[model samples]
Target chain A: MAPQGPRRGPVRDGAGRAGRPRPGSRRCAVTQRLAPRWLEAETFDCRDAFVETLVALASEDPRIVGVVNDSVGSSKLDAFRTAFPDRLVNVGIAEQDMVGMAAGLAGGGRIPFVSGAACFLTARAMEQIKVDAAYSRNNLKLCGMSPGVAYGELGPTHHSIEDVAWLRALDQLVVVVPADPVETAAAIRWAAAYEGPVFVRVSRTPVPQVHPADHTFTPGRATVLHEGDDVTLVSNGTVLWRALAAAEQLAAEGIGARVLSMASVSPLDTAAVVQAARETGALVTAEESVPRGGLGGAVAEAVVAHHPVPVRMLGVDAFAPTGSAGYLLDRYGMSPEGIARAARELLHRRRS
Target chain B: MPSTLSHAHLTLTRAPRPPAGAPRDEVVAQLRETARQIRLQDLALVHFAGAGHIGGDFSAVDVLTVLYGAVLDVAPDRVDDPERDRFVLSKGHVAGSYYVTLAAYGFLPVEQLATFLKPLSTLGGHPNRLHVPGVEASTGPLGHGLPIAVGQALAARLDSSPRQTYVLTGDGEMQEGSNWEAMMSASHYGLDNLTVVVDRNGLQQGASTEASMDLAPLADKARAFGFAVSEVDGHDHGALLDLLGSRERPGGRPRFVIAHTHKGHPISFMSDQVAWHHKVPDADQYATARAELDALAPAAGGAL
Candidate 1:
């Protein structure tokens, strides 16, 4: 049931472009329809997309350098090192130095992409991220690889579920989590061209290409995958693919659920969130990370202040038990069926 | 006075540079007088602001004086040069001395010293590179600057630039694990253009560093970290100049000069006293300390 949007205006003058999808208008074509029959075969890892794009960008821009903390193989930077031997600086297993030296390299008029494991890169070097990159407003791209439980049974110590929450609170930082290979490559090109601090997830987890080959990624914006009114589902990174799948399942059940794929976490698309609250009357956010903060927290804040709506967040809330990547996704109720079930439950809360 | 995001309005009273090789003895005497003046100014700023780390500031000021005056290819005009020498103040709690030394080098106006710690004054407790011309990094956090200096050294090599990078850290500051981490790659990269000077001021914040964490036998420690280690009386200008000469010894890893000094040196009462660490002196102590420094200093020819 598509309810009339609430009349309440924005809390701040710049809540960004209203999150509500205009009548029959779509920002991203990928959101307009389901996956075509021809697009069923090969999948691409976002990390591979990131390295290919980075190498291409580095060739034209002399300033681009890759700074890694002994994760050349994990981050897929061996090719980068071979291409630009002097440009790749392996700081030898020091995450703190990896980040700090990236800031220093920026200070010396070079653009450095500091890459490593998401867990160690974000948590181990948070202070450097805060002071050197964010507070000091240095131009450095922090590429976090194999985020979420992408490490599978490598355990909680390797889990980067807290990165979104930790980084989104910092000032002058842009946080983006691309859904698939096309968007991942697009996001890398954007981060490198854009000056100032940017944190992007270069995930090793493979997923079907969500965006078309030419589709571009924009910061502080959301791509409306499907426009519906019964409820809204929001997600990004690997979970966005599941979110889209969830919408398709809900559509089959005659529950018209809208789906929004958010790339930017810090400069969150409040307008779209407000629109989701007003039009859908309920919202369900699913991220691969923690239940709090992440995309859910950003959406909830918008919903509560501007247009109050019933919201249910889907993600791992506690320390995840040992399991493979696929098992963890299904175990934590992050599969398409589970997400669709959450959306139906939220719609119940809305209709009642 | 609001310190609101603008360049310092005050002008330099005099160009704070030495004449071309005046005489070895004269330059030493001028530098000694300059060092003494910097000490008194540091004390005054601390007294004015009612806050400072005067102990390490005093311990490090002489090392800063000799470097700014005799060493370092940086001048206010050449600050934009790609090949200019880079100096990072790793012991950044001593902003009073660093600021005063910057002033003495004409990098900042001598009058800007009055804004020390005042609200909105760019003269913050720590040096911010964005706020000052000569400041290479925004540092207050202890272990950060050494690593930044290592990156700069690496950058110089990448650029094939002849500029040398020098970083000054406290002996107590060496306890920060990041310092050792930076030192490992510094030699691994074979950075002969890098020289790290340890202001071996025996005091840390609360107690003597020997009692606090005991970074004793500091020279052996540097040599072990792949440095061509040297030791000098930190207060002696001539000996320091000799050690800091501009030369890259072929296959020499990196130079680590441990300039032995006492916290609050030359101030008889405050000397070696841990209480002087960030403690602003009272009027009587200030007057006595100034008098002691003034007796040795000649007419403050160069005061930042």
Candidate 2:
């Protein structure tokens, strides 16, 4: 089955001109046609991106390794295992031990990317992440595959919406939520090169390419995808494409909305946030995570600390009901229309 | 039976003066003096900081002294050398004592001790690798160091390096499930390069280890988890050094040393008492404790 369009490309170049198709562009065609109306071609299922990135990175760096907790299939690493048999270490279903083992491998001079379902990786082995990677200052990359409402139909137990919030609270950890495949690949390359601890969230839901291929991802910098003078739409992870589409829709209504791809949630780009607040007047932050401590809360924290501005946060307020990721995102008011409505409301508040 | 006794005596007499050709007497004496100085520094830092687990510091000071003064293959200038042995103080709340020991052994400057726990000082309440020199990892939360040490040991094994990895944990910290998880993995991987020393002071924050959580028959548990268990008097520098220096048991398994000790070892009033666990000694108590430690002369020993 071909992935849908709009989510993938013939992606728009930095100059906004539609260009040649990238290698993974075909997958998005299937998602675009099969996905619900609100989701576009740019939105991508993260499982595919994770496996693809891992396989590519392993080919480039022999020392690159994968540590999973019986999540080989769930984390979409079958191809990775087939490609590099000895590189993928499956430590059964023990999350804590899996993380510890990754730390051990890192100590042995291997760059270990620990991939697991977010809920277990963040909650079950939180202590190990805190001590082994963060505290020990080991060069470990923790890849949380299928995070946020990506597992929406499986119910709240499997949902990883709280991962960003929980991980961001820890000191000395770099928290990243890549906006799309381009950003995901960029984040992976940066994480491999960057020393020390990092938490990268890979979504199961599809998202459009919000940034250009040349987009350089700095640890604490937010990328402004579109420039406008009205309300700013800030988001990360799977919700970023929705924010961008919402910005497009808002532009039609004569509202000049700026869309920002907030890839790094921790050590947040405070200057960008403050500038967005001052220049844009109002802001609407969206994410597939909770409205608390995720992107919304982080932006709010930065804004309030330095630049106070009217802001509306859009996310899952409570545990999502059993439904597809699309249904849950729409039901929770994270669809393009919902985000556009939020931007309008925030603009109204700013005027009032 | 008589022949066995004679053989044992002959082995004891020919023990080769502590490994690495160090004279046993001199090593013991230097370690003892180092222990006293560490204790004094611990007391001073705790008093100045107004916060420290003093009792636990006292309990584990001898172990730190021996490791820094003799057993471990580490030095200040060559601290980051990958082939050098690694020491992780898992019981991080007693960071004051660890810092003092590091300073005395030239891993860090003794003058830095004065800035401990003060604002902007690298010597935090816990050992943070980013701030403190020679501190391998940040460890205040219990049960964390062993896993990292296990990783470092595994790293050494992979590289075919002879360097060993040692981690010191509080007996109470064993309650955390992560420790057992690491232990199982360590043994499964046959990490003979790893050594875990539990400061079995028998007391925790609220009460005794027995009252808090019974870890009695701790050695049996370690054995079951595929470790060579060594029960030693934690405060006895010679005993700690000897056990830490010996080769692993016949099987290539991780080693666990349960160092039995008092919460406050030497001070008459503080020893074995839980109240002094983190309580700073007042003027009178401080003077008495100082005099007690000062009266004991340094034992004689050669370098490891």
Candidate 3:
């Protein structure tokens, strides 16, 4: 059977782009339109965004609860616990038990948002996510905190570069990676209201807002951050800002590039991908995760299926060396300069 | 002691079925009829599907019949009620028995029994909660149901709801690490609202649990896990009901019942045979087994 509610048309922007249309565009249609509208100087971290949004949601609905694995301090949920002490369930350091307990809580009529380090939450509790949450169709919202190389210098064991790839392999799971605090808040609200299982990566690293304050968040839809026609630079998570910067650099070199913030990686926006292939002729995908089975792989799969176009995938190929998050990104060729160079090379190859 | 008083006290204290308000003889007769029908349905389903863990199904059929027939406070009408007690068939490969038990108890229609393991039937090889009405969880990979049951038990305690949670796992399935993890959590939480029934059928897929990974002194191990341990004949309906309904310990520790059972109970050729784990019965053997089960009238006393 089809999904429960009225089906939405394929999300497209004013210029007939992939995401919600621009302010005045006729394709900017949605059921609920209360998008985030934050000021430029209104700086907020993702942790702050998570706590503020959760507390507000809890106040409105008593069923909202937080399930953690003794990472309350790391997840910045101490304030949330103080506000709703009984609502926060800490299941010690056992990740499997934590996810299973969340499923149980959801079974008992509670909407549990399970938070923990992304590395363990995705790998350790993968079976639970597949069986209990997705297979059983439980209404559990999994918030993977501090994903990617945010735990830089701690080595590969601490980094969560495989979370996206791992979670993307599971069917019936909505994989989302919000670019900034506004997107994070919007994604959280969307998850609470959505009636299915969702896995959202909450980055610890800071990033500037790339979406408009009234930017709407929808599962399986891509957002066009900057409009260009020469080539498309697609990315999500912290790497989205880097992709936008790369697009600007490409524009400086007189190479117009379309930037797409690909938040939902599983049910990828194939129409936008095909449009980019037909209009732009080349594609470049960037992410703070492994290129294998992640955004790059997802995009490649879509391109090969319907539209075959030259594509450049940017991500860490091997276990990261010890360094800061920025240093690691630059070292792994994830910086704006690195991405721009890669896009330029792809465009050159396309001409040749 | 009269069986009436014994069954009455069992219902009064720990039985999950509707109270034994009916006449004692009537209750006994109902239990007998339910058990027989469940066996017949289970045998027919396994023969029709051409694939089933028939040995385990036959071994656990009596316990399931007793629970649904006269022990659980659940009915077809109240299946989705939050207050109804929950049963998780952890050993889900024996789904033929569970399907038949649920069907006989009116959780589903009897005609649906023919559709077991069909392409579009909800009766899959394993119990899937999304498809099955009374299944609490989808369990095929072992050791999953215990933790979920623990979670439900903890939820019951938190909500101050009197609904109890019961999970039945094969003796061999306990070797998974997840079961130990759940056991630790269940004890740590002091969940007296949960009962774990271990179908000690001895044989696993390849060999007996003892020969493969010995769980000898199983009762002591449960006690070490902070549970009130009880050992009984799994095929005896009265013994199974009484043991399943025992009171919790003073400290609110969880309960564990190690039910000693043959792999294929009441079947002369299949009982206690290791190869019968999932072996389908042939025509000749099937006829003999059906005759044996059909001849099994209600035991004169609690001696079955």
Candidate 4:
């Protein structure tokens, strides 16, 4: 149903590779060292960080409980179930029931963190999430694990590309996608403490450490990792590091680029987006999601409303063909070179 | 809120309780009268509002009255008590019935009945926990309530509170796959404190349940799903209270009560009639149904 949305301006295939820069593209200052060529060898799974932070928080607060749809192993809740055996409620493959149960549990004065695969949790039980959690304003945390095509070999059915767009459209739900382990841990802590419905996308695909150990996540706030003026590169979740690499490539070519990590997608960091649009003049958005209603859509809305600017959105725009997660991202124009090329294109559009 | 109550209705609800240690027969008689009154008020709500699921409302009334009147350990005053028994109306389209029951019991003001289905009324086609005070969960979509009830029952157990959890679902609503899922968990957890009541009316909208989707042998299905199951006459106040309030609930098992009922029950010409599923009665039909309910009213001196 989504593939048929009327495209704006031209009928370009959503995933068509119209602009690709060769490897010999102009050398930027930090391209080789930071553009994933020297990609850090260390990788930490955010799901583990999620469990660690949840266990610590649950220990401090008795109201915290874990709810799952037979995802104890997949959602990394085995340790949680062991730590607080009775507190973990596994409903066994019923996503709708799992969400509704969480709503009822929250209504009963217990803080429930509902965890499951992002694909099923968002699509299979969307109505429950909309009415029971968001409309009712229940104190619940929806931990969407292994989000954004983390299950690469399993194909499109397992991909959570539509989660941000689907959930962001529903009011009262705060959509969050942590860029790395540190942000993932911080985001988990924040959602557990907040007193309303929240969807925290906790990834399974490992990424290098990005934020500080002490970094505290605040909702609706974006972190500016690198400051520049020529163009703003907005990204989050599994693709943020690749965007960081894209910025390094831009820097090596003497193209100053601002990088904004937009973890909060629903109640987005509008002020930051507007500032980037006005100060930087052009932008490119890289996300591990569809080009619609995600980081790209949110930034475009904010920019058009406050300050109009040429925006190039680089993300998965169609059903991914069979490939590993990294291969799929590169094929969908989410690679460092791809993002850098999109940034250059956005600058050229601004010049025109 | 319903603001159209006559003076007799206002005076009748002045006493919130009968004397403590009241005779069982006397309490059951009072409950029957209250259930009759719930039917009458819901009928009026449908007539005045020009819309409601009256068939389901009438079928579930006796069971609901028995719970709010005799079984549930709750008060309008203690609605927020963490230890209080939780009652969720899973068949929520019949909210008019539940609202008046709450009003009759003083959980909601009686005058609020006039506001039902009005523009921007708190009472819509379905219950909303946010807008309504006593509704535990807002349910319209079938199969949502039992799972939530399972969660509530689980929560009570975690607190080690003796607070019981009760949820009422329509017979036809059992077709939703979610109820069976909840049934599995209710038994898996050995939730002895939870009781699920199915208003086994023979009809849903547009057709008999048997014709729509046969859900017969429901008791055995529930048993297989891990619940100790029983069937009762839904309109029999004494039978409903006895089965629902029984303290002999076995260990490590949830209780399922199948209250056999007829859609638009007891109202001659409407009983078991499929058209009344959500039909708003005209002047003549309302008068006939209202007269039947008035005749069933407890003799003024019999009980409270």
TM-scores, all candidates, are 0.89, 0.85, 0.88, 0.91
What docking grade does candidate 4 earn? medium
Of the true contacts between chains A and B, what fraction does model 1 have?
0.39
List candidate 2 segments past 4 Å from native: A1-43, A59-63, A82-110, A127-132, A135-137, A208-210, A303-309, A346-352, B1-19, B47-50, B298-304
When sorted by TM-score, best at the front, the candidate numbers are 4, 1, 3, 2
| Model 2 whole-model lDDT (C-alpha atoms) | 0.78
RMSD of each: 8.9, 9.0, 10.2, 6.9
- Over 4 Å off, model 3: A1-44, B1-19, B23-29, B246-251, B299-304
What shift in Å separates residue B116 of candidate 1 from its native position after superposition?
A: 1.9
Q: What 10-residue stretch in candidate 1 chain B is worst by lDDT?
A: B3-12
Q: Could you give me the TM-score of model 2 versus the true structure?
A: 0.85
Rate residue B260 of model 2 by lDDT: 90
Top-scoring candidate (DockQ): 4
lDDT of 4 by residue, A1-352 (tens): 0111121221111121112333543223223345334342345567888888888899999999999998999988888888999899888899988998888788688999999999999998998899888987889999998888788778999998999999999999999999877898889888988999999998876566667777778999999988899999999998888788788889999999999999999899999999999999998999999868998999999999999988998888888988656667777887778888888987887788
Chain A alone, TM-score per model: 0.88, 0.88, 0.87, 0.90
Ten contiguous residues with the weakest lDDT in model 3 chain B: B3-12
Predicted chain A of model 4: TM-score relative to the true chain A? 0.90
The better candidate by lDDT, 3 or 4, is 4
Candidate 4, superposed: residue stretches over 4 Å from native: A1-38, B1-15, B300-304
Tell me the lDDT of model 1 at B302: 32
Tens digit of lDDT per residue, candidate 2, span B59-148?
Answer: 998898888777788778877777778888889999878888887777666667777777898888888876777787678887777877
Please, what are the lDDT tens digits per residue for candidate 3 over residues B1-304? Answer: 2211121211111122445566655554566556665666676666656788988987787778777877666788887787888888889899988987887767776666667787898998999888878888888888777877887777777778888888899999999777777777888888888888999999998899999999888899889989888889888766776667544443688988898999888778889998888887766776787677767745623223
